[model samples]
Target: MTETMNNVLNDDKKWKIIQGDCLKVLEGFAPGSFDAVITDPPYASGARTQADKQKSTRQKYSSMGDNAPPAFEGDAKDQRSWTRWAAEWLAEARRIAKPGAPVCMFIDWRQLPAASDALQWAGWIWRGTAVWDKGNSRPQRGRFRQQAEYIVWGSNGDMPISRPVPCLPGVFKYGNPGKRIHLTEKPLQLMRDIVRICEPGGLILDPFAGSGTTVLAGVLEGYRAIGIEVTDVYAILAQERIVRELAEAV
Candidate 1:
């Protein structure tokens, strides 16, 4: 590692959760400094149906958009805009991640194709996708249940030589963690499983660390974690949640 890179990652046992725009914060890191990038960004501010063009797909997912919790900033970009926005940060992520470092992103089915295209456009190889089967999806009368979320994971360059001891499974079957601090709060186990893709001692960066599940996962697994959240409330929430989780573990 270069002197700059070493200085940036001087501590390998810390979890730093900063509140700011990820793209801007990402620019501060040295190139090839991170070992992995695992995150869940807004999917083009979500895909709205024709009937409810005003409301975002995420808003629609919440109960009729009335009692929906406040979504984070930058969740209103259209597909094209989001894809382009994704490329900017993704390119920065690729720049900071080591060669062959893993990149994992979460997106719903509607935005899967666009996300894959964006990842490739950002210069990462489209390795393949994994399924996060929620098992119990909302019931639809005629159409199939929306039971699965897609995870687009790839590598920065060639595959890494350091393999995981027990390979993690691709299809995650973890159930939801029930009530959420964030609208799209993922289960901690899901993030933990994803973090395992990187070596245990390696550093993981999450630009869209809503509620800090990904950062918590990295810290819990002995990997240093750096998370940037634009929303101030969520940034505080993430830190509190991490403390609470660790306290409960003890």
Candidate 2:
């Protein structure tokens, strides 16, 4: 079964979506095996309390587990412990990625400062932050509109640019497709834009490859990619998505 699945993935030219804990899965990879990492890991938003995520979404996960598509896991760590947990896997990702490999990690405004600190703690050079502005944001009476998320991006060491893409702006304005493949499904366009930051035709690693958009973007762009998803159900979905994408391209 494993070999057969591997062959299917290879048909897409080395785009792999593995089902396992990212921290455990990444351990098996040889040091510096990948050129870049563009991923969205679980945001440690709460410690013991569940993140105040949409209750409707939470209900879907609880009602469907295994029988239905996998729900979002992680994201419940408190600010203090979450940083420590993130640092561990981030450092691990660094070990697996080549020096000067670029990394882009996603986070909400609430977790901004801590996440930035985590990246530096993991030995990544803190370059700058990019904004993903979700067009048509929800506005509250007193609070500001909650329409933007951030990408804390940087290089493993020195910034390397063998294949140069046009300079992109710090802010991106795109709207959600309203399709819930995953509760927090990012736009395909967003991933396409971000993948350009990676080395052309180089191997890309997405350790927290929820729904596999990052890996899918890499493969579609002619780059080899490995996406490790902790939830096996989502792993299957991700692999299928990639396969379908590959077929559609042909």
Candidate 3:
């Protein structure tokens, strides 16, 4: 590793959160710097038309009025644009990951297909999709409830069956966080469970660390983690949350 990369990972803590464009920050890492990639990226869904997609993330995803979490960037892309962008980041992430490094990306139903395509287009072996059943959601009269998100998981290449990881579940049942600091923040325990896909004490990366859940979980689970968040507000929030939560856990 380069001097700077080593310094960043060997800091006082086992985790770090970098604030910048993920595409740009991801380029700064050395090849094979990480053992896994686990993240919940902006889905850029919840709308149909291009104009609708351009709405602020809060407007597009929440209805809590002024009480909602702050809006984030990079969620305004249309389908084609989002797919291309996903491919670029996924390719970069794959480059930074070690051989056989596992990757888990969270996405809703709307972008599930595109996410899988991006994962393969970026040269990672396509594994299977896991479900995150929220257990509850606003019920629709005639249609099914949208209570589940997906984790599209795979490996860099040739993940050996002998890798020191446990048998993980295909479906995770967890409710959403009751109090969220980010609009699409995921449940912390869910993140903790997901980070186990990496071998113990391995390093992990989360290119779209909206709230640093993956980074925090990795550290708590005995692995190193690095998170990249583009939005300034969320970058600060994520860092603060991770630090505070880690301190409390200790």
Note the Cα lDDT for every prediction shown.
0.82, 0.79, 0.92
lDDT of 1 by residue, 191-211 (tens): 888888887688899999889
Candidates by lDDT, descending order? 3, 1, 2
The number of clashing residue pairs in each candidate reads: 0, 4, 0
Q: Report the lDDT tens digits of candidate 3 across residue range 75-172.
A: 98888888999999999999989999999999999999999999999999989999999999999899999999999999999999999999999999
lDDT of 2 by residue, 141-186 (tens): 9988978889999888988555465677789888975665776778
Clashing pairs in 1: none
Query: Which 10 residues in a row give candidate 2 its minimum summed lDDT?
Result: 1-10
Question: What ranking emerges by TM-score with the best candidate at the front?
Answer: 3, 1, 2
Candidate 1: where is the Cα deviation over 4 Å?
A: 1-13, 45-58, 64-69, 161-165
The lDDT, on a scale of 0 to 1, for candidate 2 is 0.79
